[model samples]
Target chain A: MELFEEQGFEKTSAVQIAQRARVTTRTFFRYFPDKEEVLLADADADAVKETLVQHLLQKPDVTDTLQAVTRTLADFDWEKLGPRQILRQRDAMIASDPRLLERELIKQQQLTDALRDVLCRRGTAPDIAELAANTGSQVFRTAYRKWLEDNNDGDLTTITENVMSLLAAIMARGPVPATAARLP
Target chain B: MELFEEQGFEKTSAVQIAQRARVTTRTFFRYFPDKEEVLLADADADAVKETLVQHLLQKPDVTDTLQAVTRTLADFDWEKLGPRQILRQRDAMIASDPRLLERELIKQQQLTDALRDVLCRRGTAPDIAELAANTGSQVFRTAYRKWLEDNNDGDLTTITENVMSLLAAIMARGPVPATAARLP
Candidate 1:
């Protein structure tokens, strides 16, 4: 992350990265096939998804299920991660190529599908479950982006709560009057 | 869409599509550079974004501004689009390669950023705007997905309204109690 941030991802090579971390190029390759894997690693991604699913399943109420998922997400140890590590990694991925962004998005879609499946099993309508899953994941993502920007001080729970409130407010406003609206 | 569905995106050629549509190959090329553009032609995408921005600007209340954006999205002309047409495009894009999906996601991100900018301009904090934009888009997307699956029936406005309610319910529940007894 440091190397990518200071020197830019394109200019920095695996050899330099390995030397900076006091590791052999061979060791780096053994873990990550390419530079992109450093950011794309889903090692803990599955674990987090599993935790959310388990938490959601434990609550019978649909609302309670969402709350449980949010709570489990909030308890994640972002503080333990080295400062600037994630931001730098994000900068590198988004800067280096568009492909990384796509991979990240596909991963998000996968998570949504997994969550939707969980909701479906819990007896929610298929379409409603799909909507809930997508909305729930979006809440988590909104909170995560804020949490990322706050130098780790922001509580994920609070951010998630705020996102949910914002969604509710938007819903309460209902549809715009159709007669005056121009269809896009 | 028919050509792609009958065969596949990779197998279907521009010549074939042009022939099927009873249009000259010249006409096809004039509209789309490749076979992919048939699906990628987001003629209304920018217009929709612009309309949302304009609506947001017209509103004095920040909450009203966000709601206006959602309402604008719900008014999309999904009815005019053939269900098979959309499904074929989606299947082809998902099956062919990751690049197509990435491009779509980038487009979505652009929309989210635009929504965030509108909120920020309306006096909401930058972080809060970012959160609102993300959540707002999520609600829009969830409702749209449901609308699409149901053959685009049931007023989109109603679905959007329901999605917003769901978001609120999720948010109102908030995080699970930290000191509560653990789930069985």
Candidate 2:
């Protein structure tokens, strides 16, 4: 991270990262394929998929897919990922470049697909699984953004709950039409 | 459209497209700088941005940003875009190529940014506006997928409304915890 902050993500090499950690270049390769992997590829998508599906499967009696989906998101232990300040800095670094952002988006799309497939394997209907996966990913993304604040010490679980709660609150309040521009 | 459908988006040449259309290459350049623009550039982002902003501006009394955002989306006239079969074909063409999908996602991101800017201009808090824009875009994406079915004759406006309503309904039901896999 220090090297990335100093020389930018593009300029930094995986060997330099490994050297700093007093490890062999081969060791670094074993863990992450490249320097980009160090920052953005830390999250194990397969583990996340398993965790989410397991949560949904545990509650077979709960027929509402969306509810189970959001709960699965809210139940994840986000603090284990890393410190909030470090994560925020990482996010800022990724956001600085369009290519990096595109890569991140592609990763997100893959995660959505993984979740969708897991839901299908668990016997959820295809259409419902698709919706659940997309919506669940959005909920996690929204909460993760909320979780990245400097003063905000909220963990992933609480933040996820809060986001879902906000969705519910806004839905009940409904759309306000008066503020929209009316043509003369 | 016929040329692209027959030869694929990448394989077809602009000269061939122009010749097939009974127009000179010069005329084709005048209308669209390239052939890919023929498929990917139909939905003018500027026009969509203006429409969305105007809708939000007209109703100064509507304080709910999400409501205004979704309503602005629902206000788009879908039928004017052309017949369902043609639109479906276009979507399929785009879906077949990863580059086309990336372009589409980038366009969606731009729309989200446009909405966020419009909401901030309307006195909504910056954070709230950002959230509203992201959420609103998701609503549109989900509804648009549903609207693309071959036998589904549902208009975009109704589909958008139905998606938003479903969100409200799901939120009312709350999350179901038992179906989730046990942490143990």
Candidate 3:
């Protein structure tokens, strides 16, 4: 991370990262295929998604699949990934580079798909699972971004709840006239 | 679409597509830079986002940002791009190709950003605008995918409303215990 930040992501090499870590280049290849993967690695994404799914699966009630999904995500020890500053830098790097952003989005979609599948296995209706999973993830994403941006003040779960409330309020505002006419 | 399905996306060539359409290859390049763009073009994406933003701007009530966002998307004459069958084919091709899927996801993010910006300009609080825009786009995405799959029976607006109702129910069921304690 220090090297990537210093020399820029594009300029850094996998061998340099390995050497800095005191590992052989071959060892680095075993863990991550490329330097980009070192920063935006899929290595941990699967494990994280699985951990979240297992947490959601063990929840007392998932009838509120959205709550369960968002809570599971928000409640995770995200600090385990790294300090907020590092995560923010990682995100900024991904945002600035299209390839990294694409990979990040793919990782997000995979997480959403995993959440949807777990909800389905828990016996929520398929369509409901899909909607709740997608909506909850989106809500969490907004909260997560804000939590990262706010420096030190806000809590993730509270921000998530507030975002959920905003979503509810938005829905409560009733449909626009054009589509309302068509709704049964 | 037929050529892509028959020959496979990777195997098909832009020159073949242009020739089949009885247009010069230069004309094709002018319209779409490559074969992938021919399938998932950003050329139309910007225009569509601008159109949707304008539609939302014209609505009688922008306070219901979610409704306005989803309705603006669902109410668009999607057939203007192509018939449902051709659109579905395009989507399938994109889904099967990683490059195409990355382009599609990027396009989706751009649309979401545009919606958020439009809501902000309409006087919405920034956080609420972000959440509503993301949530609304997610809901519309669920509906759109289902609409594509459900052969002959569903209207996009109705499906979107159903998905929104599912979201409302999910939120109403209340938060799970762990996060509830964290919420005020």
Residue by residue across B1-184, what tens digits does model 2's lDDT show? 5567778878999898767656679866765657876754444556766776777778765567667777787777655555666566556655654545555666677778888888888787675676677877777777777787736466677667666766554444565332311111
Interface RMSD of each: 9.5, 9.4, 5.9
| DockQ comparisons of all candidates to the true complex | 0.21, 0.14, 0.31
TM-score of 1: 0.64
Model 1 over residues A59-175: C-alpha lDDT tens digits?
657645455445556666654443545554553444344445655777677777787887788877665566567666776776776666566566667777765655554444544
Tens digits of per-residue lDDT, candidate 1, B36-131, equal 867444544566667667766666566564565676567656544445446444534443444445556766877888878878887876655765
- On TM-score, the candidate that comes out on top is 3
lDDT of 3: 0.77
Chain A only: list TM-scores of all candidates: 0.64, 0.64, 0.75
| Candidate 3, pairs of clashing residues | none
Candidate 1 interface RMSD after superposing interface residues: 9.5
**Residue-level lDDT for B151 in candidate 2:** 69
Order candidates by DockQ, high to low.
Answer: 3, 1, 2
Off by over 4 Å in 3: A1-37, A175-184, B1-40, B175-184
